[model samples]
Target: MSRTTFTLDDLKRILLEGSGVPEGADLRADILDTDFTDIGYDSLALLETASRVEREYGIELDETVLGDATTPRAFVDAVGAHLSAQPV
Candidate 1:
């Protein structure tokens, strides 16, 4: 099997797809200053999103790290880092 270079947009697309969110919805718009609560992204929603992201990105997100990402930017940064560190 081959691996793909995951990009920020790719991550966003995957999240949207997995979560059944609408197209064009900004995934990184309120990052850094807002929490998932602000965007209606609850724990269940997050779980679904994370599971989807895990499958799409082929990575296992660290719960400890996910806790630190309370905003969109953090999520993006975390996902980027995870993607880089993922085994090829």
Candidate 2:
């Protein structure tokens, strides 16, 4: 088995694409530091993005983390941590 690695930027892209952010929407770098609420993502949006992450990475994310992560950076960190712990 081999481990897969992804960066915060990768996760950011995934979130932008999976969270139903509309076309022509301006996604600024502040997304990395801003709350998802500020970025117009709600619980449903996060859930959808989390599902995408799980499917893409073939890993299970803890529901608590999925639900509680407030910012894109936090989500990226949580997923990265979980992915690092998965068996390779």
Candidate 1 positional error at 11, Å: 4.9
lDDT at 40 for candidate 1?
53
**RMSD after CA superposition, every candidate:** 3.7, 2.6
Residue-by-residue lDDT tens digits, candidate 2, 1-88: 2337767667667767877574544575556777777777778878888888888888888989866689777887888888889876
The TM-scores, one per candidate, come to 0.66, 0.80
Give lDDT per model, in order: 0.65, 0.75
The clash count of every prediction, one per candidate, is 2, 0
lDDT of 1 by residue, 4-88 (tens): 4545566456556756554544556743456766755666666776677777667788886567877656777777788787666
C-alpha displacement of 47 in model 2, angstroms? 0.5
- Rate residue 34 of model 2 by lDDT: 76
Question: Which regions of candidate 2 are displaced past 4 Å?
Answer: 1-3, 22-25
Candidate No. with top TM-score: 2
